[model samples]
Target: MDKSGNMIDKMLTQNGLVYKIPNKVAAKQGPAFLQKQRSGSVAYTQGVAAEQQACHWLEQDGWTVLLRRARTHRGEIDIVASKAAVLCFVEVKKRRSIEEALVSLQPAQQRRLFRAAECLLQKHPYWQYEEMRFDLFVFDNAGKMERLEDILRQM
Candidate 1:
């Protein structure tokens, strides 16, 4: 078969026509795509590890973690924990340094977290608590963790 005929055959499958990139095209773009994929995977892994460590710390401190990686229509909450009669919505940040992690949470993100917490409270009326607060948990690359209580009130 000619080159065009062979290409057409490669694109066809039992289910339907599938667009298969020719080797030449893939070879030209594969390196950049692979690099991005690797970086994204690394970031995701690090974030998960940080969250796990944060949860462990909370548990050790006699806090019950109600949720981790909670999703709402407004935004995502990293952690939701309770101690005594207080409920906390926590935002976790891991960076090269504690300073970097502290600065990572911007005003816009704070607003989003507040909205997400409100959504969560409305969705689950059974979560009884005398007080609710927003907390910031920052972690450095060296495994140091710092918890800032009532972060919104501090601001």
Candidate 2:
């Protein structure tokens, strides 16, 4: 038994029933682990909300959203949208300031996004387009939004 009065190991009963035990390490971590999990959940929810807003903005601009939160072996693509013959892989970032959000997407992450886009194209051959580009959509906590088109072209 640990300090919390919980059994740290499995207990066997005379009636041939075995009681499952909690992990001692996890039990010991307790509140700290739970706090981390809660923060992670909050971040995930915020990310989803940002992606939804990005999709809405795209639709307003005559773009059709093909996929939201598209997952590949490389990484996740926030939004895949098409307008006419152009296809865009958009990366959404939300931060306290536009500069902060823009800087959050580093070069390594850009490489991952490129690889993820390739993986997605391979998986969905029907997403063909005459032109494809990478874009960055940033939102600051002040409700300001900005779109940087052909983000990789400048790289």
Candidate 3:
């Protein structure tokens, strides 16, 4: 059981699924579904990798990570972190530039973030904190984190 878990863990760690290529020859024949399928697969893999990195970064900074890739009816919160007395809900954007990163967040995305946070609060009322806020994490194409901004404080 431990060995199976370890194998799954290794397969899950990093964006290992991104390397999986679809049958391009099959795609060319008719529907071209393989291309879209591969793209979606890669996206899911990248999202997992980004979530893992965000959790690791928060933990390194001394915050206890509560969750990663937390989902609600509205949308997903990439990371949930707590320390001292604050609960931070995070959205991670991975891009090639700062502009691209910021552009990734739209008004609809903000609404989803708020709804997800509210859902979390409802579920975990015992998790007391002096404050709660939504945060944005920007990661460059090289997998380096460039910025972390608290969007809640601004609003």
Candidate 4:
């Protein structure tokens, strides 16, 4: 721990009470992060709705969803599904068109998603035997759904 953190621990142990010293940078950035974190008030509500729609559709399509919104230090995976020994990691995006939605998932983002998937698999060894696949769920402007299976096949 840092010197300040050690000092805080020492003072708390001595006094049998703890007082927090707020981080100035964190305090300055907190409101924006808090606003984004609000479940009902976040600007990402549309994206969340789209992901929910995709999850429902996946269930209907006979996929066993294992995780939703799984995260790692690298990035977040929207959904994880499995069927017949195949594990799918999904990316859900809503845009005006299928092309636009697919384009939105940039190459850099794809790498991060892959890294996140690796992290999840490492944490759960039971999943190691399954064949991993990357899939995309694109919600079009007309409220239509398009599923692109095995997206990373081209990668």
TM-score of each predicted structure versus truth: 0.81, 0.82, 0.74, 0.70
lDDT of 1 by residue, 19-90 (tens): 754555444545587688898898789999999988999999999999999999999999999999999998
Candidate 1 global CA lDDT score: 0.86
In terms of lDDT, the best-performing candidate is 2
Task: Report clash pairs, candidate 2.
Answer: none
Better candidate by lDDT, 1 or 3: 1
lDDT of 3: 0.76
For candidate 3, which ten residues in a row score worst on lDDT? 1-10
Higher-TM-score candidate among 3 and 4? 3
Error of 4 at 86 (Å): 0.6
lDDT of 3 by residue, 52-142 (tens): 8888888898989998888888788888999899899988887777678878999888888888888988988889899887778877777
Point out the worst 10-residue segment of candidate 2 by lDDT: 1-10
Stretches of candidate 4 above 4 Å error?
A: 1-43, 153-155
C-alpha local distance difference test of each model: 0.86, 0.88, 0.76, 0.81
Error of 4 at 95 (Å): 1.5
Candidate 3 stretches with Cα past 4 Å from truth are: 1-31, 153-155
> TM-score: which is higher, 1 or 3?
1
Which residue segments of model 2 deviate by more than 4 Å? 1-19
Q: How far does residue 56 in candidate 3 sit from its true spot (Å)?
A: 0.7
Number of the candidate with higher TM-score, 1 or 2 = 2
- Full ranking by lDDT: 2, 1, 4, 3
* Evaluation by lDDT, superior candidate among 1 and 4: 1
